[model samples]
Target: MTRSAIELPVTADDRRIARLAALAIGLTLAEAAIPSPIPGVKPGLANIVILLVLLQYGWRAAAWVSVLRLLAGGLLLGSLFAPGFWLAAAGALVSLSVLGLARHLPDRYFGPVSLSVLAAFGHIGGQLALAGIWLLPAAALLKLLPVFAAAALIFGAVNGVIVARLLAGPVSSGRQSGSCTPPSIP
Candidate 1:
């Protein structure tokens, strides 16, 4: 694969975004250490960082952070270009798109939790769809949708709560919402 070259130097904001991506990547690695009863059922702890980035820096920064985490985490886990990476990339893309749309909703009607839930469902849906089209390609895979949805709902709510709490903190809101500030890491 050909890589693109950057003509400009990395800015302070880029460093901050890299720090956020590193945090998400760390969580992804740690989550990988835990065993799940179901193959695709994981709490998605790294999502908290993505959701936080979304609320603070908008969908563009969140997209960057999510992609960085996936690439870095996949490489670290030796899952790059594997089936898992394709599933993860699809999920991340869907989740980012969901966040992009959800962010436009009135603040009074929906917040991080709602947005998180939407992204979570989108994430799982994307993975399931990809699995159906590529990996399994069987009607039996459809049976797992409900299970994945349940996991997404539960884990999404938990992650949403964590992100909401982070947003509630003074450090993450106000003047620093659009820029990276040293907020307390959860």
Candidate 2:
């Protein structure tokens, strides 16, 4: 018997998310090329896309973008299910979890910069915790925490400011609430 082909319904939202995921994957690949003095201390450039999606779409869409990035990035990098992949996965999950809760916060104080910082810490904290449990010892994590925390703060703030500026720009400022399409990024 011949097997029938399966076709999934793809909406505009689906296509948009795919594009965003591709952006994230590109960032991830670029990040992998950057040299880091400390292990697991990359700038987490993909998260910029994730945070942007979270602010514009919601946690659900952000999560989809993040997961797709992780899976596709891992596959492209040839590190699927590897230790590096697990560490990144742990970080992304925690970062998304933080955004899910933090989105309920008022827009005044918890704007893109603040939320990005929170997600950054969450990502680094989650990665260190998982690494400690699965790969390294507690002492190593403690030693690495200061460096990772510093990196998280700096990178998160930068990414957040970028998103905030994007949102504040003339192109994005006119967006109506509940709009699904993102503004044309310059």
Candidate 3:
């Protein structure tokens, strides 16, 4: 008797990862398109997607998406080595690190909202660090920190809300499928 072979379809997790990566890239472009009074400041909307990816998929996938977004944004905007690119790379690295660490916390502690907030702070801190390294020494732009911090707080809250909402549906579905893992607390 000849037996027929069956093909297994791609898992939901795989589909989710692809979708999140695409979303991250799209958001990155949108954020990049927004004009800032100062060149280095951004809403970092893409970080929201990165945070969601880290929460739902894993750090590896999140890192890949972040790097892709960074490179693509730089290429699209014709600013590969511009100070803004460096600032963005710094922010992305810091935020991704925070998300990776947060992934280890107990789910009851952080959740999406808190995780978003932590990631935002890390993003801003990274930008500040980069600015200090590249621009602050000249004293020409040191006065911008307060404005940058305020923008970070406002945009961070917005990104946090977007992440929280994106994760809600997945959390509910994962719970139903018995595939949900409690996210790390902040």
By lDDT, the best candidate is 2
lDDT of 3 by residue, 39-69 (tens): 6677877777787777766799789878878
Give the Cα lDDT of each candidate.
0.86, 0.88, 0.75
Q: What are the per-model numbers of colliding residue pairs?
A: 0, 0, 3
Best by TM-score: 2
Q: Write down the RMSD of candidate 3 (Cα, Å).
A: 7.5
Quick one: ranking by TM-score, best first? 2, 1, 3
**Which residue pairs overlap in candidate 2's backbone?**
none
TM-score of 3: 0.74
lDDT of 1 by residue, 110-179 (tens): 8878888899999998888889898885677778878988899999998988887676556543454553
What would the TM-scores of all predictions be? 0.86, 0.89, 0.74
